[model samples]
Target: MAATEPAGSRHRNEAGPVGDQVRANLKFFRARQGISTTQLARLLEALGRPILATAITKIESGDRKVDVGDLVALALALRTTPNRMLLPDYGPSRGQADVALTPTVTVFPDLAWAWASGKQQLLAAEIALGHGEESPFEVLEEFRRNALTTAERQHADHTAVRAAEAVLSSIRGILDRIDNPVRYDVEDESRARHPDSAARLGPAPATPEGLRARLRSLIAEIDALIGDDSDG
Candidate 1:
């Protein structure tokens, strides 16, 4: 591996408890299902935006910290848990901890669930910013004007748009990911997703273009409620 690679790429390095688990489980499923990164990314795209091969590589290698959202997506992707990824036998742990662990145990679903819930919170927050009257779109215009007039204050519309786009793209990506159907039990959908996300689970379109149209529709409804033509 190259020195430029992240900590996860180094073979000489030891994997902490969670990292080890992710590596093991991803390897297990990828080989078992014979799924390629392109296929997996397609699945991810179905779930939201397009994930690159490198992103998948970083994730599988435990280079990136697997948050709850990542774990949920991974589990949904490979059909396993965060704990199972860390180590095959790891059950859910007792509390929210950030530390080292023994190599023997993997990850717990509860821990993964906690992490996933955190991810959902973040998504919800981003969605909240973009939704209804909170149109980051409208906010951007005001902020930009203020920033330009104020000393050293940037309006941050770019930042806001990026954030909103991320939320929107992720929603699109989730749409792409689920279409492939790794292990989407109705039970899992109800248990694992936010109410809004769960509702969107049924009968997602086959293409991103179609999903974008629906997103536009949702945005239009928001536009009406806010009665503002300019979102940003």
Candidate 2:
């Protein structure tokens, strides 16, 4: 009788296209950032979850599997969003290629990307007709059941706007600190000296200008959604 392969070895032998895409993108992003495996491992450690350089190499080479936690950590360490790491890197022109989301599931790159980015839901017939192709009776009913009331939607819009504004404020604060470190240090010292006089601050912002642009885009998107719902 043949000897059994180790349980951990299953991923290496059974890895599919989705795994392949992830591995390729992992290597691509790491290289794009000019980060070595050792550097990436250190970054992950700084993020509070340590992954050895050898394991990272295995993950990149399709010899290891990446769990959800690792995926998030890798994305953070690489300064990218999780969806960007999960999706395939279609070239500049983004040629019409079918992306395999699962062993039995494949979709056009656009649909796959949209679904991954929370822009659209994956439907049974989407592979054939593309997203928002038709609103069938069941789908319409499902939407109706889960649809937000007008007041609720307006409240959500306001909440989103407020959140975006908060993030923008945080980003501006970070930029200010970077541009005027001496003044920021003095302010920090003052704040430390007088706890009661210190102003509360939001969480640290991600990727400064890029994040600001994304927040603007998200606010615009929320406005568009509200407009579309109102029209409907």
In terms of TM-score, how similar is model 1 to the real structure? 0.32
For all candidates, what are the clash counts? Answer: 31, 0
Deviation from native of the Cα of residue 86 in model 1, angstroms: 3.5
Off by over 4 Å in 1: 1-15, 89-232
Per-residue accuracy of model 2 over 8-99 as CA lDDT, tens digit each:
87763566787787788898998888999999999999999899999999998877898889989988999987888778765324244678
Give me the candidate number with maximum TM-score: 2
lDDT of each: 0.55, 0.70
* Lowest lDDT block of 10, candidate 1: 114-123
TM-score of each: 0.32, 0.52
Model 1 scores a C-alpha lDDT of 0.55
Candidate 1 residues 1-232, lDDT tens each? 5458776766864556657657667767888999887788788677665567778888777775555666667777777665556544422233324323344322334334433433212223344456456455565454445434453233323444434454465464455356434423554556466767755754343335545655666565556656667656
The positional error of residue 101 in candidate 1, measured at the CA in angstroms, is 3.5
